[model samples]
Target: MATDVRVHLVDDNTPFRDSTAWLLETAGFEVHAYPSGPAFLAEWPSRRRGDGAECVVSDIRMPEMSGLQLQDTLRRQGCNVPLVFVTAHGDVPLAVEAMRKGASNFLEKPFSDDALLDSIRNAVAGARARGDGAVDSEVLAKLSPRERQVLDLVVASKPNKVIADILGISIKTVELHRANMMAKLGVRSLPELMKVALGHG
Candidate 1:
């Protein structure tokens, strides 16, 4: 019902992208369509509002960057744009993982137009509740690139050893960066940390 919200749609399939954009437009929502993840990312910096009150609808599988990776990149860049992933039926696990990683929602392929609209409505509402993605972007902008990278891994709820292994850093180095990020973000505990981190995307 929120007609003013902008929906950014990205899909490798030209027909799917065009059709979905048309469907969303017909529903009284404004939409911007992109052919691929990199293409969208290239434009987002100039297009996003300072508050980032936008939602992205992307296919789960694309040529260069998957929908999941797009979500991660947004988080890393501090955009925190709400995301609704489109997935094949068999990619339900990927959808769930996207949700676990803070995607707004997911729609199965060949979904009813109503289903996608409903998901967009929910995403827009969530963005309103989250204060329009402004705080996250500002807070993350204060961190260095390395800190943001560490925070990205940290947001996955990974442990120190696991994070270090994944990033190819020593455990002590990971711990140091973790401590630095928490202090930089003014969070005193893990629960608080997760609250501030996951509260964004």
Candidate 2:
């Protein structure tokens, strides 16, 4: 239940941070809002460790100590609090790298309320099941041969048109294959797909 989750919300933008905190709190999550990554890190050790699921939801871009850098710092300190990055469309590649480094999930900016809630829930659950950003062989085996082919090209960063041309298929067919591949792999983003393909941490 939402009430069983605790979210540490970090973003440089005060309005966005407060609004997101309010949204999460409204959804029944216990939220602690931070204006910067440093602020969160400074209080991380002192923060209450609740009995239920706990995670950090942070914006990828910040003027002082970006989210990725914060994530790295946490990792170096052996902190495994699950991290869910919030990123703009242009910062997706950075978010992908965060996944490879063991972030639990990331939401694109302008994401829906349910999208954020679902991401936080899934991040906590997935972390408990297999640690963050993990893709196992069993999950990989779910893809069909065609889906696997699409997965490979997609992980290679090929656009739909290029993938279609390379695979001798129509663009729509490539899109179908790509969609199916991601579904079968249980990955929502290209960076997640690449994390699976590249065998990241």
On TM-score, the candidate that comes out on top is 2
List candidate 1 segments past 4 Å from native: 132-201
Clashing pairs in 1: none
Cα RMSD for predicted model 1: 8.7
How does model 1 score by TM-score? 0.64
In angstroms, how far off is 11's CA in candidate 1?
A: 0.3
Across 1-201, the per-residue lDDT of candidate 2 in tens digits comes to 679788999999989998899999999998999999889988888884733378899999999999999999988987787788999999977876776576766778999998788778766654544443355768768888778667655643457875676566899999888888888877789877766665552
In candidate 2, position 68 carries an lDDT of: 94
Error of 2 at 93 (Å): 1.0
C-alpha TM-scores of all predictions: 0.64, 0.66
